[model samples]
Target: MTLLLLLAAAALQPAVEPQPSLAAKELRRIPAEEARQGATAGHGSVYAIGNHEIGRYDAKTGQRVARWDGDPAQFPHLNSCELDGRDLVCAASNYPNVPMSSQILWFDATTLKLRRTHSLGHGHGSLTWVTRHAGAWYACYANYDGKGGEPGRDHRETTVVRLDDRLNETALWTFPDSVLERFSPRSASGGAWGDDGLLYVTGHDRPEMYVMRVPAKGSVLEHVTTIALPTDGQAIGWEQGQNRVLWSIERKRTEMVASRVPPVK
Candidate 1:
């Protein structure tokens, strides 16, 4: 009778679905002094992002073309950047400081000059990455466990917010448990919506990108798959005009690396 009951319980349990994995192929590396935070590609140029500086390099020649330096007091931590039309939209924050605050900085892609700033005053963790998808803006607010964390919240509180054209929050969602486990102490540092209609995000220092989708029934994002990358994560950007090419940074080497990411099945 005991054996029969155990067998019945096992039959009632759901079968575990295998998690799919994909590998990104490294394409090329470009040395950029400002590649400490992240990199973005657009308009025949690749921009290397630093805390308060940005260097634009020729994507084909790998030669430095233009550079922009901002006041560190105003722009302390520039986490990541993405190319949107004629501008390079960047995520900035006052990290490792109490009461985290974030802002969105836009620079002219041609001149590499600061064009505008929109302050997203303290509330939803440090803004790590932001991008536009399907006419809506998606932003990642990262909450760390130790250094840059707040009083009550930790990494588990990291969130993704959707905003309208004017940047008003419309909806919000959190990461899945499995993906959150990968970001235990440090939170997600980069995120972008892929052309394939999936969201790809990277953790603080992992050489992996989690492919996710907004769940139809919950406030948590669904983990669809994982992709292995060549560079340890800080911030990532998808190359403009390229199908599935991603641009990331090698912080230690101060280099910008490009990888061809495979499509999820």
Candidate 2:
């Protein structure tokens, strides 16, 4: 009787596919080995890339498009990515697999084809992603001292790179120690920008997020505020409209939360 019941339950649910949501939701969920973090737009379209492959999706329309291997050589580990004009810029790194090394890869926005890959050098580090501001593209990364970002993985600083419209790095800005201290307790995690002209980053240490003003006419950024978050907060970003809306993603539970970041009175 128990066996029969188990069989009945199994029959009710569809057989698990390589990526269930990609097929069910009409949005390609890149292979886990290839993608870890993703970004979406207002029209139900999302860009999923990381690890070694890249995919595009339209959740509502159920269109899942993928490029077999975005960058196979850099595969198995891309921490984060973002859309730049008509390109997908990713921060490729060896997290637990390989320590202290990562690179940036550029792909054509339409076909999801590889355009160029830049070696960013070695350091126990992971980049948050890239975004456009003042007609320039930028990406941020956390640098650690030890392996797999172990507890001993002392962070020296966070970096921001200026890229061309084609997604190539042209200039770099390394936040100084004073600016890094505001994030006193380092938690090398996700980050995003706010319409308030602030950059928001998350922490693994506790249920909290921090906001800092993008330095004006300077290289070092300044911390402005810290917001409380749920325990499982894994990634964060801000979407600007009437006001800057802040979003937090709890990956494990597949949940997300949004809040507003308003102007200073």
Candidate 3:
């Protein structure tokens, strides 16, 4: 196979982790109020997370209650997260590395404790965002070329996949040309299932979210609409309560922003 083809083939293999060198740590403290990449609210608490750490806060008082720090070399690159029942499911990847690999990291919603790590054999793209919807799981596999060691990747190479409950791939969908243009070199950053039955997603740095839905008979998702967001980051969350607002973290500000999304027509 050609060099580019070889890389593409390697991307389909299972993710590999470095040898365990140090033990992961736990702390009952707060993370730096900035650098937050994702957020989720559940179990009477709110989680603010960065690529390096995760913090739990009281839902009402917003007071930091617990924290967990990942080994820098082990649990790096946590992008976005969503509350799956009592667990916080996060989409993580090894960026700046060639043949990007990814993992689905899970945490206990009440304690912010790491519970499980599901390696998503690097196939779809570079799993940037993942969420469960309608009895199935949906994931965004992102690709970055030129700057991120993926020189073979063009703007149109990214994709989203539907998986069974066991996380086995079932189908795949490519973003529309217009949405792919917004991603450019980077694929979708954040994704969540909206209350309106649409899959909402954000680009790496764009301050807008794209709404998409699986088509009845096609490999490409149907572009529904776009909504401006207050902040941008690598992942997004949707509040599950009656308010039903959207949540995102501003990595630069290290802060979380929430907004209400109008139901699609």
Best by TM-score: 1
> Alpha-carbon error at 241 in model 2, in Å?
7.0
Candidate 2: list runs displaced more than 4 Å. 1-35, 59-73, 97-99, 123-125, 149-153, 161-186, 204-207, 216-219, 229-248, 254-265
Assess candidate 1 and give its TM-score to the true structure: 0.92
* lDDT (tens digit, per residue) of candidate 1 on 1-265: 9999999999999877334388899999999999999998977899999988999999999999999999989889999999999999999999878799999999999898899999999988999999889999999999988999998998999999999999999999999889998888999998988989999999988889999999888799999989999999889999988989999999999999999999898
Error of 2 at 240 (Å): 7.6
Model 2 residue 217 CA deviation (Å) reads: 7.1
* Pairs with backbone N, CA or C atoms under 3 Å apart (clashes), candidate 2: 26-62, 51-77, 51-78, 52-75, 100-123, 100-124
TM-score per candidate, chains pooled: 0.92, 0.62, 0.84
List model 3 lDDT by residue over 1-265, tens digit each: 5999999999999767222122212112223373367776666666787876887777667678888788868866777778888888888878756677889988887777899998886675677888898899988888775565365676588888889988988898898987887777677888888777889888887777788888999899888777766665457777678355666766776766666666666
**Each prediction's whole-model lDDT (CA):** 0.92, 0.54, 0.74
Q: For residues 23-58, could you state the per-residue lDDT of candidate 2 as single tens digits?
A: 101112222222244333322345544346655654
Residue 118 lDDT in model 3?
A: 87
Q: Write down the lDDT that model 1 would get.
A: 0.92
Clashes per model (N, Cα, C within 3 A): 0, 6, 2
